[model samples]
Target: MTPPAALTLEFVSKHNVEGDLWIIVDSSVYDISKFATIHPGGLSVLLNGDIAGQDATKAFYGLHRSEILRRPQYARLKIGELVGRDEQQQNVPPDAIGSTSSIPYAEPTWLAPGYRSPYYKDSHRQFQLAVRQFVEDVIFPDAQRHEEDGKPPSQHVFDEMGRLNIIAMRLGPGKHLQGRALMRGIVKPEEFDHFHELIIAQELGRIHARGYSDGLGGGTCIGLPPILNFGKPVLRDKIVPDVLAGKKFISLAVTEAFAGSDVAGLKCHAKRVKDGWVVTGTYARLPESPKDRSVYVPLFSVFAARTDAGGLVVLVIPRSDGVQTKLIKTSYSTAAGTAYVTFDEVHVPYENTLGSDNGGLQVILSNFNHERWGLTCGAVSAQRTILEECLKWATQREVFGKPLASQAVVRSKLAQMIARVETSQNWLESITFQMVHMNYKEQASKLAGQIAFLKMFTSRNAQDTARDAVQLFGGRGITRSGMGKFIEHYHRTLLIDAVGGGAEDVLGDLGVRQALRMMPKNVRL
Candidate 1:
């Protein structure tokens, strides 16, 4: 809809009272009167006499980031532009508005009009738009709320994701998504590729609340794949549909107190029982299990454990009689439901065993490539976001009577951050390109080492980006509220990506080991 005609400063001043309050920011006007009471910061800040009848650009930036002004909540309040500003200059072309942010490197290069990418096509673009809209309109608000409340996303959020077929699409390209209407009809199932999956991960990472991101669907992103790929057809048919539809929640139960990245070292053991298998073990701290079955379903856990044969086994254990969960608090919020799960002789039917008994290592290993790739995608996007935050903060914040961007030291940091982010993103795209062209078996053999290195490199870049971002954001960066929220949250949870998929040291070594296996037999060093 066209914005109401530009309003003069005099006209804005008249509506400054409690019931009809309006304020200007960057030459655009917002009617935030109705939003005052519900503002997360508080109502008094808006009602304060000093803010009435004035442009609130300074105060707004002081308490909130620029993204707030761009959110749909604030967008709807924007009735018009300031009277003296040039309309053409102030207005973004309709088509270009959300395609890319004005900040450099904030989005993929392909999203920028002048740039081109052979990897992305019209379907990819359509998919990106649909996912972005869904994230902004549906997921982001819930993420913000749950991030603060330390609760998982509401069922409505999951239901909406199910409706969009996002839960299924997130597993990366596969037969699972085939024949399904994806992203609510924006892209066909056959057209979905790794690039499309990458777009989803990056777009969701834009939420910037890692805990909330995990809480929303992050667990299922890594957890449900084993069941989908290796579970018996009867088992897959029984649970996969419900989980993908967001009626239930599942997690990959592999990490233990004794073993993290060293999957082979896991002590969780499965013993043969009369009818099936008896599994008993403890998972590394993860989020809490859902309490309400109607609103949520803690459906399944793909438990990886050792059998009597001294080889690994994977079981699809439903939340049942002997299963127990306790919440484990971490640096980030509890929204992720990070829990300490215990399977006390939990009985799993023989039919629930995924892949071959005592040969489940490959099943688990196969899932890691995509899992790490997803983490790499998120890490790179997050660093880009951090760079964007630094750029905006430097330009707007003043130090020693000049903008922070004017300082040579800050400029150097920004340059380094941008370079790292761009390089990682380019590498990630290249790997994704290979994924699109190669089949699953080819990817497993050819791209494993490359993906591992990419994850390691991207995560290492995140560590640097987070540190630099914290330095740039200063006191606000360390603080949780106000202008530095994204920086602070990212800094606190950056290790999740670095360590969760695979620790940097382990992955770096694994990449080298894998590459050596593919080394030429007779070539000189």
Candidate 2:
């Protein structure tokens, strides 16, 4: 047989260049068709990439630069030394309808083996480590600063994310990979019982409120991913390096004043203009709780809009400009400073448009899978904290004539919490495994629903376990010097169970839909 043809590069010439299929290398066209379907912004973005290819490469800053580098699963592609003009050639349109293939990818050489992980054999495991280190070291410390500044923690926390390479991990070294692959590689479920994940979350949760919030979603979870997922290369170049380095910050602005889970029903709109787009709408902020004596500050948010070329798309309009943020204080996430942000004709450049116009819904939804999984991880950790705290109390605190450990009722509750943690953590790992291996097209399928359900389940269980721990502590539990802080945190975590990726009812419905899809046709009820 003839030697296998070299994996030749396809390029777009003056004759045939689609709107999104080609990229400019130096001066000539370079076909990124292989990366088209796998693009985090969805296929439409790739089409637009073709149209904006030259300008995209030339962009120095803004959202467009950020999106280009945010591919969720891009760690798999090799970053080859781009050849000069001599190797450039015309792109050959494939007879195939869409995308090059449907498969998960592997890590690139840039993520060398020596980097430090026992679970490197599994991509999901590597991803989990990335998230853990990021939250513990960078995000948490920033939250502590927010506690002092009376402002939300986004600015400083995100600035550090850019430094640690955490933000870059999503789309950093490999450009050819897809989101599903990176997600799966980050954390595999079965690796730990649900309780194990909970144990980690609990340890992190022990930090002050700001620290915990930042570690969870205060920055990394809500900030970097979206920009990376749909923003153009111009946006990517400006934002990613900074956010990864902790120099900048960003956040998701999907939950509206009226709409919570019904993303498709958003009322926000972006009117098109000659140079760019203008977004106008209101975002709600949480009201502060009296129980929380700590000082609280608020933040404005960017909003999502639908444009002529792209449907349901999002933009990052800062609090300083035409945008306004109203703080809606709540009992939870005191460190986060929840708020409702309203936009009034916020101008966004043509290049600032993230992903394809009207593709915002898909862009936002596609990213939820990871967000949900992360919440589950955090929730599990919260439960572990409850167990650890209860254990400490049981061994020391006297009950009646004996230590609480001798009480059957207390032991029952502690054991139950541990059991629940185990169940949730194991499920989390299993789901993580499936995520790493999941095909591109199937990313939003039944498995996505599983992630949602796990998030709901884990969050609820974590809340309940925390409550039980406080109850078990009896008198000491209610005091600030005793379990007071833990009890305060317990209530705070309950709110998280319903928000980050989705609410319980929403995830339940999604799980139902997924279950229905998995049934055989003849088995209809």
Candidate 3:
């Protein structure tokens, strides 16, 4: 196809009318005569006499973001470059424009060639590329489809993940991943650290299908840790391989209708029987359940419940007779298999007890640091995506004959969103670095409060970013399709991150309390 010829300023000016509207933006001319009526800001803005025959550069910048010019629908309307401008400078190579986003802060600082980071290495970059390709090519489509269909990712997805050892890799650096090949062997096991885990969480979040991301292996991410770290050797040997191989599903079930972060307030009871234990009560927001149609056989759950001894206990219970699950739909997709699980006289073998009889509190608490950190990583990454979306929207979406990004108010909101996201990401990296060097016990002792606070902070930041993105997107933000689907989904579901990993209020107080204990005797108020 022949390229469109460039139009002179005189030629552009001649077509400036209601019937033949033409406008110049960034030295390019667009014929928006047909788009006037459909423009969200209304027709008068496009038909104004002053804008009709002249360059609408200033006006266009005020409403639309730069990305709008790249949209196929708008790009096709381009008649040509301005008559006097250098053609080479005016026309950007298609490949360069398509490869990476031009909007500032649209990607992480590390992804930009001019920026440097001490944290990421060649392995991290290679791993990132492989994971991104996998997500974009394989996981993203599945996530979107399953999210819309209100179902979980297919078994084939799990099998593929199992083949690549992604399930084991997500658990962070541990003995379980020691021998496993990860990210198609892009990074060696011995070299894997919290940074690599951070990469995985962030990349997975890019799928933008939160529920489906959880469904793919969300349950296992949290559930298998206790079993692998503290369960009896026989139990660990029996369950770990199958779960990691994607032949089984497991989840952590600690919250109930009456008690969420208040672990001590749990009402589910487990009584010791002659040969085993009988558990009875309900657990809410479980990520995996046998009742979910997509789950395979041998579904398992690790939950904390009250024992007859009046102390909290953790049990790894398998789905069997008398174990019932009822779906509890939330703002996010049901692909997560959020469930109200009831263990009615369900027999759990003594061997199934994950930690010591009444010592389950430590086991449960031990997982929180990792869990909250994971939430922080995902939330921060999601916020970045939201920021990028807003940047693209503001640049491409014109209002009053200018790009939305050109508006001062929109720029202010974008600045705030970017600041919050960057702050959270830096904090997350700092905390992750600590995890890499500190032993588990040291991490639990020294970093718990910090992780809690970080999670709380990021959740709040996500709320702010989501709000700004929705406002920038306008109607499309609320609508489920088109440019706003991600922002819409994020707005509706961001609360899960705020409340799930430990509610913001709960964690905020916990951080202060934990910090108080570490205060020095010599330090005065």
Model 1 misplacement above 4 A: 1-63, 66-99, 285-297
The residue-by-residue lDDT of candidate 3 on 39-67, one tens digit each, is 88888888777688678876675555455
Cα misplacement distance, residue 108 of candidate 1 (Å): 0.6
lDDT of 2: 0.54
Better model by lDDT: candidate 1 vs candidate 2: 1
Candidates ranked by TM-score = 1, 3, 2
For each candidate, what is the lDDT? 0.82, 0.54, 0.82
CA RMSD of all predictions: 4.4, 25.5, 5.0
TM-score of 3: 0.83
What lDDT score goes with residue 28 in model 3? 80
